[model samples]
Target: MSGRKTGALLVLVLLALLGACSPAPECSSHQDCPPGQLCLSNRCQPGSPADGAADAGADPGRDAGADPGSDGADAGADPAGDAGADAGADAGADTGADPGADAAGDTGADAGDEAADSGPGDCLDPDGDGYGTGTSCLGPDCAPDDAERHPGAPELCNGLDDDCDGVPDQGGVCPQANPYLWVFLLAGQSNMVGLGVNSELGGADASGVNNVHIFCDLSVHNDGNPHCLHWVTPLVPGFGVLPDRFGPELSFGRRLHELWPNRSLAIIKIAEGGTALADRWAARDGDLYQLLVQQVTTQMNDLHIAWSPRLVAFVWMQGESDACSSDTANAYYLNLRNFIQALRQDLGVDLLPITAGLIADQPMWPEAGKVRDATSLLADHLGPMDVVETTDLPRHPDDLAHYDTAGQLELGRRFAEAVNALLADRDWEFPGDFSRAQGDGFWRYQACQGASCSLLSWDLFRRYWKNASATVLIGDGWVQPAESQAAEISWWAPWDGRIQVTASAVLAASGGDGTMVSIFRNERLLAGPRPLTAGSGASFDLLLDVEQGQRLRFITDSGSTADGELDRTTWQITVHMSRVAGD
Candidate 1:
């Protein structure tokens, strides 16, 4: 036959063989077909481009079957999968070699919430530590195949993040001598378990901060230790009750670092949403209270062996829940006092400097004032204690009780400052009782149109005047001048001699002309009339000589546009001095 005819004859024979075979059936998904068929173009065809190896990251069951969904639902054979595992619903449920997980049976991964799709490896944890083994384990665990190599574990000579503090091998000598970790303990309800979104944080803040660490229980009401967290990780956003949200810890830790950059800081936080101090945080038989005790004790115990762990501060931001209940509000003072005492006892620290944030006076809780009063009274009784005033702190526009991101950050800064002051032990003058400084007292709040300023009553100073914002104390007790007028917070020099002045200011308006902030010794200008634009700020540190009974004032003027209307200037002024030569 001719070459063409022979080709046709062979083609005819191939056609005949093809016609004898059964037609491929249509399929919506891989599950709709039997083994040996691929759902291609809606048809169960003979060849599947995707084999079991392609789904190696699927649930630890019989991943040999190519299942696109469910935990190892495929029964089809996968020659390419690691360890001849069956993905069958029954017989193939476990990895044939080592149960559901990889060969070592310890990768802490679920089909949900884990990174997927890498070629099969151990990914299992052979040891009992709550982390997976192998490099491909659930987290960024170096030496994942080894149980002794997780975060917070003792730093071995292994070139890994043995302590799991982002750096491998202690970031230096194996657990260097006196790696003193400055510890801060945080306790409270939803406010402490902050609701601020991570995305709201600026630049590098969205990632973990260096040298600052966090170990927290983000869950609510769990009796034992919480899960899904490392022993300790670089302090990052998402340590709040919500996995992706963060609390004041971010700001608090960062501020502490800013204040004393050389010290290594760690924050151990355990907080829940909507928890009450009178009940949930009571010193007696409180589950959360007990858990807080356990977590802190456990952390201290764990670190004390190899680290010089110093508990520097205890910060509390509770009471909103209590504020909603009359009985809780009434009992708040004693409850808080006992709670602090018990925490001190359990943590084995006495007279620890404590800072608690006062709930904002909002309509969410009618008894909020009672709780605030209790905090004030508690402070009077507890010598090394202080309160953070938050009445004017901003909250989410849509939520009455919850603080927004900016509010959360400010709360942290205030807590840091309070703790810093207690530790400094200087007779510096600021608002230790952070509740608004009495207008009738040394710190006076007043308003001015141009140069003529008159003091307003505390009530007028706290409330809007002339249909505009008043000169008021805001988050962390920073005073903000009104948008419609220049404002002043004046103080009388208590002694004669050189005085150290530390002050800062930031624009605090949604939209505005900037403001000119000035500090004057009576009529003598000391600093500023310096301009501050939106989201921008200036800090002043000065040593000025003054006579006793001098009228010193921190003042804000309208911006260069000279329009005081809608220019919000927020500032803090602190004065520190020694007694003059003979009082």
Candidate 2:
């Protein structure tokens, strides 16, 4: 037979087999049957493919069964059909060997096919931690032990790798360290959490600073240690620590670095949005204060962060929270004083200076006089403390609180100013302001061995002169006393220089134990202390051409500590230096 005839016969055989397997049509309803088939009840009945005619009494299945081609017997029936039928029968006999083993009729594939389908013997290996021997389709690979899944254990607070092997919080558990680190605890309420923006601070081109790391609590009362930080009043306008972001501009510390240019700083911020001083930070006995303590302690412990070098200052930007509270402005001052004292105790610093942000001038705090008075009282009462006035900065519309990015940055700068001022005070040696000092040199006053008081080193100081707090005494009791011997020293302007030195101080001691001021040039005592009079500080200026290398010191001969305040002294000195040539 020609190949074409064989192909046609094979196609015919397939059609017959498919026709035999189809279900008999049932007639249920009129729509169930072909248009020509009448629905006796509700079943669909068979009909001709076209014209809606019924092929009555025709049987395709039976036709195929009776033909010699159907039983695989006729030579003209198509050998391909015969071959397929033989293959089916052979497959039935084995029930396992595949019929597609090979079209070329080779059984070599039998062993390979069996091997390819075989699974491991019985040994569990789930995560492929390697040494398992198993034989089951669902054996080791699909076993629970073979996989490392994130089950999200409940031991998030223990700070341990709770789930067995090596890592903690691996499976939906808390991460060994949350990727969202560098958190700033946002307390208070809307202000600290943020009231958002009227417009972008630096416009679309403005990029936010990450210096003030921010984190937040899940809810206001959430006990979970939040890793988010929310800034109080941002330094730059847009620099507040938000939900999952920080903005406005740079933070106080960032600006601090800019001003100092040589200091390392970190910010552990925690400002509440709508918190009040009396409510949020009352005392440890108070609910809000306790909450703050817990947060601060937990963060420090969990992250093992030490508050030093890094913890340069505490920024308190709260009065608004307490503005309308029962704590009157005076009470606010009292509470703030206690809070400051508590913070110092907790932080283990004798004088942890704080920079308090004053309520900006606006409608919310229209008459900020109270706020100012309260803050001023706190600053004055609190030792080594200062204030960052918001009076000069722009305020939000509500004016009750908050600022735009520019206002925020200015606030940050002010905060930084307070801090730098504190630092500068601590250094305490500059004659005038740091901004205007002559030749980068310091006038070191050394009271080494009684009568030898003198201006010594600038870059280095001997152990005896290393006392950063070098105060001069006038009298036996901080005033001129009878028969008291006062030590004085001085250094002449290297050239014919005019020094503008201003001294304003109070003599806390009694009697002849008073201080004296003097100037010396080339071994010639040009002038002597016109007595820094009792109870009042004195100032003196003498236009004398103290040549280079001239020496100066205070000399007193009328007071004795034998019957007066021992070491009765403390004089605050501030001196300004400039070239006579006026460069």
Candidate 3:
């Protein structure tokens, strides 16, 4: 036990003291702890109360030793209180026991994972408008309750955005402005029924023009045709009473389709043969006029089912029968006016333009000229009326009254020209020089036995020409003019010019010595003081210089016969005026 023995003993004592002062082994799990011990604050400690207190002071990582009466873990809360609170108290407080700390920590980690699993930006949407509520989600809805109040929806006339494009009712999805079909009404007599043979022109194919439609009033035929009272499309040859015949409508519709290829064009045609304006086709009730109205409205309703219809114009081509009788011819102008007015009223289009086709003159119809004159007067009376001359159109080979196929084709093209002029708001100029004098400066006169010579104005003349009597006597006795046999007419010159004024009169006498007929302008002699015998007719023309606003007058004189028998003589007179060239 010298120096070496003493050094070894000292070393052993120091090692023992160091071991006693050292910290307990740390653990993160129960498996990391010794047998019968628990892991707490990453350290292995005793499970029993006595052992727990003994080891608590033995490990400096824990608090100083607790008294036997106090709980060992609670006593460890004194020194290093925060450490004890976090490790011992808090762990136990979280799990209700120290052993349950790991379970509590694992439960907290599971809760965090659950919160992460649920989408962070996912928002609650109470309303199902394809858009979400709350600021946290994509496609945030401005209004959640209204389905129509969403984005990218159609905007309607309603105050809201139906199409949900930021702007309302102004974009591509907005309602169309004018969704209407342009409509035309074709009505009149045999000409309107289209007597031109369809085979002559090889017919037209309206089927190729998909937008043009037509509804013919076959009810007037009373033939039990299926399309009689219904609307039909693609106007073709069989529209008239005769299957081989067609009217101006075929070409007219084709031209219209060419003009408006994108829009729907509908034509409602109601016409019949031998219809006179004075009787069956008169504007008054109980006539074919009401039937025309009914047909038009019925077709309009049918058209409206697919698209709204706008009545653009009315085309009238008739008057042949009216020209057969002098009475009807005389009343033609007034009858036409009434018909147009009534038509406008019934159709609810006050300014509806009427394109009338003047009846052609026929040798069989002597009074046809009178009807033509009345039509001219009709044009003068109505502002929106236009007259298309058919006198120059070639007549059918078999029939003298109706137009031939080529003429009918031209007539249809003319009708289209007129319609286009009207729709384009352009002025329509008539074909000849007579068009300038249409409103005035033309007159027709007839005088009969025992009747006072009547000085009728244009309007009056058209109404009462037939009732005014005039008998033409053509053989050998002495004859005299009717009482007050002279009639006169006057008109103001529209421009300063030399106008060619012409007057013609047909005279008849029964064995008259002679009769003197005369014509004058502004009380100055212009024509005849010419003397003639029985059964004579003559014409006179004068070129006279006239100033603007100057008035001209026409006069006729017939001398007395030996017997004073005025009934034996009568006369008819016609006067025409035209502006001279280089005026």
Lowest lDDT 10-residue stretch of candidate 2: 102-111
Ranking by TM-score: 3, 1, 2
Candidate 2 error regions (>4 Å): 1-190, 196-199, 203-205, 208-250, 260-262, 301-310, 325-327, 362-367, 398-400, 429-562, 565-583
Candidate 3's displacement at residue 296, Å, is 1.1
lDDT of 2 at 307: 24
Q: If scored against the real structure, what TM-score would every candidate get?
A: 0.43, 0.40, 0.44
lDDT of each: 0.59, 0.39, 0.52
Runs in model 3 deviating more than 4 A are 1-178, 203-208, 219-227, 426-583
Give the per-residue lDDT of model 3 (tens digit) for 1-583. 8999999999999999997887769864334566766554456766732232223223321112322112232222111111111122222211112221110000000011112332444433222333444343335433332322345543333212333343323444223433557788888887777766655665344333467777887445636344445556666655666656677887788887777676678888888878888888788563688889887877777765666466777899988888887888888888888988788767655456678888887777778898888887777766456788888898777887777777777787788777766554211111111122222222223233222333332224323222234322122111234444543333433323344444444446455565565543322233345555556655554444443223344343455633234333343322233432121
* Top TM-score hit: 3
lDDT of 1 at 401: 83
Return the TM-score for candidate 3, rounded to 2 decimals.
Answer: 0.44
Ranking by lDDT: 1, 3, 2
Model 1 accuracy (lDDT, Cα):
0.59
Query: Model 2, 30-76: lDDT tens per residue?
Result: 33455455332123444322211122122111111232213222122
lDDT of 1 by residue, 293-354 (tens): 88888887788776656676799998999999799999999888888877766665544668
